[model samples]
Target: MDRSSQCDEPSSPAESPSPPAAHGENEKNAQFLTGLRLYGVLIGTSVASFLISLDTSVISTAIPSITTQFHSTPDITWYASAYPLTLCSLQPLSGKLTTIFSPRWTYQTFFIIFLLGSLLCGVAPNSSTFILGRAVAGAGGRLSLYSFGTILGPIMGGALTEKVGWRWCFYINLPAGAVTVATLFLFFHPPQKKPATPLTPREKLLQLDLLGCVLFTASIVMVLLALQWGGNQHPWNSPLIIALFTGFSITIIAFTIWEQRQGDSAMIPLSVLLRRSVLFSVLFASLLLSSFVIPVYYLPEWFQIVLGATPLQSGIYMLPSVISQLLGAIFSGVLAKRIPYYNPWFFLGSSLLCIASGLYTTFTVFSTPPAKWISFQILQGLGCGLAAQMPLLTVQATLITSPAQIPLGISLVLFAQYFGSSLAQSIGGAIFQNILASQLEQEAGLDKTQIQELLRAGNAKVRETVAESFPQSLNAVLEAYNMSIFRVFWFPVTGSAVAFILAGGIEWVDLRDMASSEGSENRVVDEFSKPGAKQGGSRAGV
Candidate 1:
């Protein structure tokens, strides 16, 4: 085994070392952090994860305040979509950068970027600047606390919005991020594997595949722009919309071709992506996330606009879903660890989510019972939590034999998740805005100017104004909002159904056996320093 051969191609199963030899190699390769340092590192990473989750979930409740202050309802989608746009677009580049550079320094750099973006958002004077800040923050964001931060984000966002202002939502990250950065700098020291061959800085830069990143990012921007503008800011058949879609198609095709040609050096390696488990994982994750993200973004709006709840009230109202989701995730993890298969959980979760989404369409401006809405939230949350992490687990298990490919595999799945979220939010926003505008005009007799005014006035102002001025149309206005939100809910229903169907395609493996045998020769750590280490391998058996 020599370094040159290791870089050339992946080794086959027959070339793997024996179990005893592998155990010895694993011992030699393992890096352990003990005592206070280990605990410090764990706390640091957990706080960082919490910050990411907070950034993601905190904005939902504060969106109405932001829109009101900026008086730009048209830019609501951008507020939600912008962050995910850059997050997904630059995800691969971040991964490549970490591999090429020191992980600690790279992490610090990203943290600094995120902090700066947060500052920009906190001090933003307009919608455009705020959206730009979100995009910048997203480019540096990648981490989560599973469900704990999710449970607190809305509550904290609402409290800050009511007591201080919506700007505090971004400002809140500053102190927290500073502490997290300090903790990580002092305590976290990850083991880095040197490359098989030393390369110049130019060579390392080239490995980032900036062209592929540009093409992929361009393709995403084109489609998002089309979604944002079509039938909202511009006519669906307008030249700009048509051109955007056309560009997306062409750029995506070019990205695919380029990626194929690049082979292992590609941002998303075809050698890992084409596997049955990994491909299914990517699709399942994307669709499942779409189903989950729609409710996370829109449910607060439903509470605020349709039901006339304040921001703080809406955050409290979201507790059922968030708490249930956390419970479901913990339950699912426990069951999956004990069970031999995870496909059943996926099927069950998707079924619950599909049912919940369908049920959400039945909500109206009046006469919906608390028990019904509460139960619906629980069902949707439980469904999302149960299935959300299975795809990652599946990918990791499948790629255990090809350790070097694990990170790449995980990154692709995550990219799909974020990309799906961005696309879904844009589509959902478009659906809600377009339908609400049309329905308000037809049913409530509100003109475009009045509608814009009503949107800018905030929920409380809108209620007072409508009751005082258009008393007879107040019910109609609320109904229009309800109908529009219900229509948006249908997208999640479709997404959940598609995920249910895709669950059949996910190849199953006995995780129990895999865990038990992980220390054996089959579970090789494909280190770059090793001469004969396998970079990729055949798909894990079903």
Candidate 2:
């Protein structure tokens, strides 16, 4: 009944003999880096993480400019969604690749891919090309050291866009990526654990579960396309939209059946996913990220369009949110070591996020105070930061008995996080577009052509154009934009509330005790095997 059995696969004759227990322990200890070399690896990986995190957030402030240049305002959803879509879909494969190959080489391969994608985006001539580049970059990216880069991404993106051009936002990755690649090549000496069975290159490739990845990606794309096109490019009841949704349901069901049959080799191991701790954790991570991404994207638009702030100014305004999120993350991480139960932090964090999102929906075009908006942002960021990382920690804690399962468990949660962000952006964009169009038509009395012109002009040009030509309807137009954005805020408001409820479902495990017990792993296996053990119930004094 050992949990490790679920991760087992058939052995190969080419595999090397297993080392003695004592020798294996020594090998494990030898892998631990110390001194300056450890610091160098940290620096290298942290920079890589920064690049990945920066890519996600930097495009937020620059979206307005990109839409303006391309005159493809409707494509805003794809601009942000495309990267995360590929990142989410390809994440499990990346994890498997690192397992089959050396982490150092795998890391470099992904870095090169990311750099190429960045170059493509930097020189992209049109909206479609840019979105393609974003997807390419996303395929090559992985997650790590998130907060610092995320804090600087918006500000840096805005400065680069205004002072030079938005392309610089992507161009900046080349130099940074080169430094990361060199540092990793030189200092990253991860101890290689000999696989129980050595496989040929073809075998390793087959283990990637490419079909599962494709099916999963197709299903997600179907849903996103439906959301993006619904009520915007096509009617909600249109054939194309209906087909997309139908495809999503069918593909998702197929993906589930395939994964169940694939067993341990599945892209997402159903055995690990079925655990109560992991299931709730995955849900919480998805909802928390969805809530967080909505504000990160739309707040910049609100600042630029409604408040009349420049891109640089809008980025500056985001400082409160980003900085607060970092602080909240740090605080929760530190407290987690001292506090026994993680669920409390989850509860408090989700509560704060829900409240902050509700406050966001009350924002007005003219009367809302700077202090009000800033405080709400701080609250939202703090909540997101506090809860954002708990799911990973929860998975690691729950699967402590199965050391091999930890990586896969973490990957599943990470996939959910990015997938949620991707879906949120598409849904938010749809809401914003549909509501804005309707309000402009009814309240501002603008026709379809006029509305399209205003959208193509970009957020920065909206007020100016309205005042210049439609002076009589300028106030109404601004009001329409404000109302549309506020309506979009409701999505996160609902998301955060749902996350709060899911937080209660997280199993209560005392980390301090888990670390103290020498036989904790055996104890965990025993508890899991129990017939009537209530999932997520307290395990105190076990």
| Candidate of highest TM-score | 2
lDDT scores for all predictions? Answer: 0.76, 0.78
Candidate 1: global Cα-lDDT? 0.76
Model 2 ranges with Cα > 4 A deviation: 1-43, 143-147, 186-197, 511-516, 519-542
Write one digit per residue (lDDT tens) for candidate 2, span 1-542: 12422211111101111222354464454545678776777677767777877888898888888888888878888998998889888867765665567656766788788889999999999989999999989888752324357778899989988899999999999998888888778877655556667888899888999889999999998998898889989999999999999999999999999999999899989999999999999988888888888888899999988998888888999988887887787787777767887798788888898899899999988999999989998998889777776776688688888755665776788778878889999999899989999999998899988898898787667888788778888889989999999999999889989988988888898777787778765555544332211112100000
lDDT of 2: 0.78
Best by lDDT: 2
RMSD, each candidate, Å? 6.7, 6.8
Q: Residue-wise lDDT of candidate 1 within 1-542, one digit each (tens)?
A: 11111111122111222121344665686656788777776676666667766888889899988888887776778888888778778766765665667767777777778888889999999988999999888887743223257678889888888889989999988998887778777876655557668889999989998889899989988998898889988999999999999999999999999999999889778889999989988888888888887888788888888888888888898888888887787687767656888788879888899999999999988898889889998999888878877776677677777776766786777778778888888899889878988998998899878787777765435577688767788889999888988999999899999989999998878766676684622343434334223332111000
Residue 161, candidate 2: how far off, in angstroms?
A: 1.3
